[model samples]
Target: MNRLTAVTLGVADLEASAGFYSGIFDTPPNRDHDGVCFFPLPGCWISLFPLGHLAEDISPEVPKTRSGFSGVTLAHNVKTKDEVIAVLERARAAGAAIVKEAQDTFWGGFSGYFADPDGYHWEVVWGPMFDFTDDGALLFGKG
Candidate 1:
């Protein structure tokens, strides 16, 4: 069986990326080294690795370009609309770009988007139909 373990981001500077996420998430890195750092999230891990190292690990022939969305956006579900706003503010202060500010959505949720330094998108949301634990794990659902 294959299970998702971590979401690794390619960053221009590992230390800077680590600092950004550490501030926004309010958690220190589980492991930090010269070329990489790791943060353990609710049920997964987020890792920051140098861009050149990541490219070489994947494939030396891979092309590098900063264009278009990567079709992947991480989501952080909070308990209240106020939390949504607060988190967005923290993210913005940590140098994340506000791709979309928090607002009520048609899907019965309040959500927003932010992009990390490398352009990876994240959606911070609050859904009335779901409950999340303090550790950021989903505890209940409407269904």
Candidate 2:
């Protein structure tokens, strides 16, 4: 219960979303089922399923339509400030809209944001206080 294994985004178009993610991830999906796609990362997986179906799976009470902000953001951390800009540009080229340009953060870091085709916000960030494990999982704090 303490660990997060995956983050599933309910997307509008399965094929388009899959393609968009594949392009930015630089790899094909590890698994594609009748209604879902999965991309495996270093520490977890990103799953995409149709919005309506995802809502149905949750419960009949959940709304199928999404609007405004979902109050959630996915993040990709980089090793340097330059890499943050690079990743944001890459995402833009892959069909994401640049929601926020790369800039310095009040916490003494660099970051920016982009909205995916499904309107999901992804933050590309670089923090001096962050590091990575040998296998590439994002590590917080310098201890």
Candidate 3:
């Protein structure tokens, strides 16, 4: 019960948004229904639904325009800086907005950022100072 089941994004057009995600993930939606598209992630799913419906489901007060920094980001951890570059390139090729090019950071890592069709920020990163288990779970300061 403690595990997250899904992370859903509010989108303007389900088809276009789903298409954009398909290209980014290099896979089609695991499930597509009348009003939503669902992509399976490692331990959860990413869902896309119409913005209006999402607003209604959550609360009518939810802001319609999600622009600028929404103070939220999604991240994918990689084992190397080359992997980071590869992911960013794929995202760009899939029509993502490359917000930041891969580069060494003061935190002793290499990373880049991209914005998906809905302007959700994602970071591809390689942190030599962090440890990752066989299943890719991250543990800090254990490099």
Candidate 4:
């Protein structure tokens, strides 16, 4: 219960979503089924599935409508401030809408936001207080 192995996004067009993510990652999905795609990331995996099917898979009562903020965001952390801008630009070129231009954060970080085709928010950040292990697991407050 303390670990996250995957984050699944309910998307309108599975192929388009998969292609979007593939362009961002510069790698093809590890698994691409009829209506699902899985990209294996450093610390976890990201999966895209048809929105309607995902809602039904949750419960028959769950609504498939998606709108507005979903109260959750996925983040990509880099070691340098320039990388933050680079990632955001890469995402924009891959078809994401830049929701917020990169700026200095009150938390002493450089960051920005972008929305995927399905309107899922993603933050590209670089914090002075953060680092990563050799295997890419995020390390915070470790000097």
Candidate order (lDDT): 4, 2, 1, 3
Task: Give the count of colliding residue pairs in each prediction.
Answer: 0, 0, 0, 0
Model 4 C-alpha lDDT per residue in residues 33-139, reported as the tens digit of each score: 77789998888999999999999999999999899998999999998989998889889999999999999999889999999999999999999889899998898
Q: lDDT of each model, Cα atoms only?
A: 0.87, 0.91, 0.85, 0.92
Model 4 ranges off by over 4 Å: none
lDDT, model 4, position 19:
89
lDDT of 2 by residue, 50-72 (tens): 99999999999999989988899
By summed lDDT, the worst window of 10 consecutive residues in model 3 runs over 134-143
Model 2: ten consecutive residues of lowest lDDT: 26-35
After superposition of all CA atoms, the RMSD between model 3 and the true structure is 2.2
Model 3: per-residue lDDT, tens digit, 65-92? 5667889998878888898999999899
Q: Residue 93 deviation, candidate 1, in Å?
A: 1.0
lDDT for 104 (candidate 4): 97
Candidate 1 lDDT score relative to the true structure: 0.87
Clashing pairs in 4: none
